[model samples]
Target: MALTQQQRVELSSLVGDRRVDAVVAGRARMVLWRDEGRSAEEVAALAGVSRPTVNTWVRRYHDHGVPGLADRPRPGKPAEVPGSVRARILALTRMAPPAVTGLTHWSSRELANYLARHEETRVSHNFIADLWRQHGLAPHRSGTFKLSRDPAFADKVVDIVGLYLNPPDGAVVLCVDEKTQVQALDRTQPLLPIDFDRTEKRTHDYVRHGTTNLFAALNTATGTVTARCFPKRRGAEFLTFMKTIAAAYPGRELHVVVDNLSTHTTDEVKTWLADNPRIVFHFTPTGSSWLNMVEIWFGIITRQAIRRGTFTSVTRLTRAINDYVTAWNTDAKPFVWTATPSEILTKVRWVHTEVRKLLTNNDK
Candidate 1:
């Protein structure tokens, strides 16, 4: 092939530039080699392509220049289901199934059957499944949510998030909560140990020895937990736990984050707080106990230590809890809070707007 100087420069740039497509670059290199008087077979060997491919690109370049070296559009098989059918499937997937159908959510087969009978749109269940996957729809799954109705929700959010992200100097921030009614459960039968292709098995029934409440204080700076188990969750127990936390970090101002539990705000607790002026309380918004970092630690302990433990007595369960706490604090790492108050407030407002729209539509 013979090329103009400008064409040669363009082809040379495409061959050398890394950003160009490999196939286009290879074709450019082949044409350049042909222009340099290299034989087709030699160019094919250098480009790792067949002689036929080299000759075909040379012919393409001769006929339509650089544009002809690129791939042609491939007309693949047309869609089996029409766009309107796909749209209807997605729209129905977002809604609860008809009450007459006695379905809480739409299964692929059920949805396909319904459409075939009612809408005269006959499609296989597999096609419905594929359509749902394509649009990221899952009617079978649902999640729970709650919006705080506290009048001071925004103020409380700002106060708590501020403590988490930017604690005051010379002060200790503790997320305090009580995990109540932790049962000591013993399996009815000995657990069958897990082996290859076999999971650990235990009886579904358990003997409940007793229950205890755990009061935990999580240090936001160091992630260490100061915890104790009590027979009851009451004002007296909460006050004692507070005293323990205060004693643990003497001579420092303490900011305790707690939920709006009645025990936490009892008259006795209030009187004690009045006496200990250095310790202050920050109440999370009602129904928003997840704000307390200790709750996250509580979940970890439950899953790791208590859930599968075969505790024959409350003392054994309490000992198990203490051991887990000791192990956790040995390698403690803080759960860093990243969400700002404004981001949280935005999401809350969006939830409120969505709920209002849903209620309004339901009334209509």
Candidate 2:
């Protein structure tokens, strides 16, 4: 018999519930397998039950709903561990340890020890760990997020993202940035090159051979990059790169997306922009380097070339970067932006509200 939507949902819920008796849960899973059109043998193998057991549950579920899977009173002594004790353990696991416990979280041993002392219930540490796994709880991890505090965040995001989604017909939109202080270090010992089965190996120690700064412009539409290595990341170098980019895309309007780095908006850079009116610089929101697509390319080049490759001198490192960029542009696909401006703004507003609340609480 075909299961109703509600019956299927209830059966799945019963299977997911850790509090359910093992036999009842197994029966729920077996019925669900058959509902999915699996044969008796497949259900038996999947649920770790005999073919006869599968048939019994399937027939029971077909006759009655999920309630049919309930075990008839078994002729045996009652359970050793009471239901209240199990629930208490699960509840305590969900909460932080009592401040008196002097612990941030409950480890299996600590939880077991605490429960035995407070509730006078004797349960093993292994049992506590098993309960935690069943209920899908983990208190030993953390994650992070950052909110942009730039006053003009919204406007800057709109300007840069707009260029990505819709570019002027004849304009070259470039995501420009500098990867500064790239070190060129040579390993004291030569690296062992990769072979058929062995991985490439390099010594832990290395010789510092100085560093170089890379100024790059990634074509938003073409996925190609124009890059130059400079000894310093000065506004003069930025102006020189801007001139190169202008000459490369001769006569077309240039819209460059950049971060709010001090050097990017220096007097010399501003003067250069004034002279070249066609080249406009759009800065991404502060603390939001992710908005710049060039950073993505920077990550790719670092992982593939610079991270492990040995460079005896800055000259070698620069050549390696140029080589990788050349190879990348041959098949590079433009990074697509999917988050709409409204969606981004909504998230930013929520983050702003949270940050404000935190500051207000701190002041108190």
Candidate 3:
């Protein structure tokens, strides 16, 4: 039967409408398939029904329009699962399993079993899983988070973020940090290179040559990095790097953003800062190394070079680090900081509130 444009539109709408009963929707889809020149057998197979069933729906759709697709009233018992019960099931899934259950979280099987055991609801694990999918709930997975407990988090955030967003004119703003104890480890055997249907493979064991510390100063304005490798991460090494960065941007005042390490705040470092008068230090809040943009550079280098690299000695490792830094500076872009101090503090406050609620619940 040829469908008018209006009939085709209505049939298409019924086939796509999720609010319609699935049986009705399936029948609508069958009619659409027939309209598209599919034989009854093909339509039946696609609809997972008999050829007669497909023919019946197509004929009914032709006779009675969309109403023909709905299931006719039949003499049978209604569904046993109550709406309230399903709501309760969803509510339970959102909550932690009771202490007696000895579960950190709920699996579909566990949740179904718990419901059956406690409230005597005869639900299958598959049914529970379907319910979860329909409602978009997942109780099985979790992520890790930490609250910054720094007292001066606000002040430090504004200071560092300020330099990143609006740097001082004529002064150099550098994010300085040490990637400490970078190890040179060679695989026990040569790595098997990847090919069709295979991954690159390396031996589990490795030979540790030694470790070196990379002190890097990331130029916030231009994204170029000035780096030096050191055998030690002492105040002396840090001061030397500071001087190197200072000399690199000669005669300009330097605004260095560093994490609050003991070495960074040592009396010796303090005296050097006083001597250099033009070099100013802005310490990131305790435990918040993410504020320093150098950490982002460290992540890039580690992922691109250090993590999977094979090195025989600290010298080779240093050479690799220098090579990567040199390449990075050639095309480096400054890591832009977009979060305002108020925005950051607002998010931290929300996290703090969440942590407090968790602690309170635990206490109860």
lDDT scores in order: 0.80, 0.76, 0.78
The residue ranges of model 1 lying beyond 4 angstroms of the native Cα positions read: 1-145, 189-204
Q: Write the residue-wise lDDT of candidate 3 on 72-191 in tens digits.
A: 766888466777667667666655567788865676778887888887888866667778889776664321113456898889889888888888888889999999999998976432
Worst 10 residues of 3 by lDDT: 192-201
RMSD of each: 17.6, 15.8, 14.6
Candidate 2 TM-score to native: 0.56
How many clashes in each structure? 0, 0, 0
> Candidate 2 on 1-364: residue-level lDDT in tens?
8888998999888865545554577788788888899999987766556999999988988887777888666698845766666766765654557767886566667787887887688897667777777867554321111356689988887888788888888888999999989999887643211111122223355788999999999998888999999999888888888888899987789999988888889998888889889989898887677688888788777757986678999999999998988898889788777776777788667656654654565468
Select the stronger candidate by TM-score from 2 and 3: 3
As for lDDT, the candidate ahead, 1 or 2, is 1
Candidate 3: where is the Cα deviation over 4 Å?
1-145, 189-204
Angstrom error of the Cα, residue 113, model 2: value is: 28
Positional deviation of 309 in candidate 1, in angstroms?
A: 0.9
Q: Measured by TM-score, how close is model 3 to the native structure? A: 0.59
How close is every model to the real structure, measured as TM-score?
A: 0.60, 0.56, 0.59
Candidates by TM-score, descending order: 1, 3, 2
